[model samples]
Target: MTTKKLTWVSMLLAMCVLGANFKLLGSIALDSFPAFLGAMILGPVYGAFLGIAGHFVSALLAGFPQTLPIHIIIGFLMGICMFIFGLVRKKAMGDGIMVKAVSWLIAYIVSVPLNLLILYPVLHEVVFVLFVPLTIATLANLLISELVYAVLPSKIKNFGQSKVV
Candidate 1:
C-alpha cells in the first residue's frame, strides 16, 4: 500500500487499540468504531485488519476470559464482519442514508448467525447472556462510526475513495 494509506491505517489501528480500553462487558468494547471507520474510509481489507486486531487487543486486555482460542475465532469472525460491512457500503454507494442503514442492518444480521454457529453449541444455556451486550455494542459501534463518517466534510470523506473505501 502507499505510504499515505499506510499512515491512515496505522492511525485507525491505534484508535482501535485505544478503544479496546473501554470495556462494556467481558471482551466486548468500543473498539469496532475504528474498524468501521477504516472500512468506510480505507476499504474492507483494512477494516478486517482493524477488526481482528481490535478484538485481539480487547481480548488480551480482558485476560482472554473466554480463552485464547475462542477469542481467536471471534477475532476472525469480527474481521469477516468488517469485510462485509465495507463491501455493503462500497456497493451501496450513492445514497448515504441507505448505505448506513443497510450496512449496519446487514452487519448486525450476519453477526447473529455467525456467533450462534459456535456460541449456541458451546454455551447453550447461557448464550443468551451475551446477546444484550452484543446488540448494544454492535449498534453503538456502527452507529457512532456512521455518524462520524456522515459528519465529515465532503473532501475529508473522500480521503480514500479512489483506493477503494
Candidate 2:
C-alpha cells in the first residue's frame, strides 16, 4: 500500500476500535462502519484486514481474547458482504441505501449462527432475539459511514479507485 493508503487504513482501524468501545443500542457497537468504508473505498482485501486487525486490537484492549474469533469472523463477513454489495447490483451500489442494507443483512445473517453457536455461552444470556438491535445498530453504522463518505470531495472519495482497478 502507498503511504496515503496506509494512513487511511490506520485511521479506519482506529475508528473501528473506537466504535466498538461505544454501544449505541444495547450492546451493539458501530464498529463495522469503518470496515464497510474500507471495503467501499479500498476493496474487499483491505476491508478484511481492517476488520480483522480492528477486532483483534479491540479484543485485546478490552481484555477479552477468548471471544476474538467471533468478532474477527463478523468483521470478515462484513468485508465480503460490502464488497459484493458495492460491486454487484446494477443500480443501487456505491452510496445507495440498498447497498448498505444488503451488506448489513448479509453480514448479520451470517453472524447469527456464528454468534449463537460459539459466543452464546460467553454472553451467558439468550442470544436469538438480539438480532433486532444488531440490525438497527448495523444500519446506523453503515448510514453514518456512508454519509461521511458521501460528503467527502469526489477526489478523496475516489482516492483508491485507481489503485483498485
Candidate 3:
C-alpha cells in the first residue's frame, strides 16, 4: 500500500480505538487507554488526531473542563513526541522491546508537563502531591500501551504500515 493510504487507514483505526477507549473507560488517562500507542503506531498527524478527538469526545461526554484548548495542546505535544518515536522506529524498523521502551520513555517525558500544566489546573487540583502519582500513572500507561502495540499480531502491525506511494 502507499504511504497516504496507510496513513488514512491508521487514522481511521486510531479514531476507532479512541472511541472505544472513551466509551469503555470514560477517561483519557490510563483508566481508558494511552493515546501514545496510537501516535507511535500511526504517524504523528494521525496520532494527534486520535489524541485530540478522543479527548474532545470524552470531555464532552464526561464533562471535562477546558476540553478544547487543553486537549489540543496535549495532543499536539504528544503527537510530536510520538512522531519522534515513529522516526526512530522507522530508522530501526524493528519490532523489539528496546524500541517500545524508548517510545514509552519519550511519551512519558512529553506527557508530564502537558498533564501538570494543562490538565491539572483544569481539573482544579494542585500539582503538589498529585504530580508524582500522575507522572507515574502516565508513564505506566504509556509503557503498557506501547507494549500492547509492539506485541500485536502481524495483521494489526500491517494496519500501521505506511503506504505513502
Residue runs of model 2 more than 4 Å from their true location after superposition: 24-27, 82-108, 111-125
Per-residue lDDT over 16-41 for candidate 2, one digit per residue giving the tens place of the 0 to 100 score: 88987866434366776787777767
Model 1 per-residue lDDT tens digits across residues 1-165: 887789989999999989899999998899999999998887789999999999999999999988888888889889999999988877675746767778888788756556756767766765577788888888899888988887988775677677533
Badly placed stretches (over 4 Å) of model 3 are 1-28, 31-34, 66-68, 114-125, 129-133, 162-165
The TM-score obtained by model 3 is 0.62
Tell me how many clashing residue pairs each candidate has.
0, 0, 7
Candidate 2 TM-score, C-alpha based: 0.71
- The C-alpha RMSD in Å for every predicted model, in order, reads 2.0, 3.9, 4.5
TM-scores for the candidates: 0.92, 0.71, 0.62
lDDT by residue (1-165, candidate 3, tens digit) is: 566546655665454445534332233444323345555555555555555555555556555544566656655655565566556665565767787667656666666665566656565665455567647656665666666766877765665564534
Q: Candidate 1 — which residues are off by over 4 angstroms?
A: 163-165
**TM-score winner, 1 or 3:** 1
What is candidate 2's local distance difference test score? 0.64
Q: What is the lDDT, from 0 to 100, of the residue 128 in candidate 2? A: 60
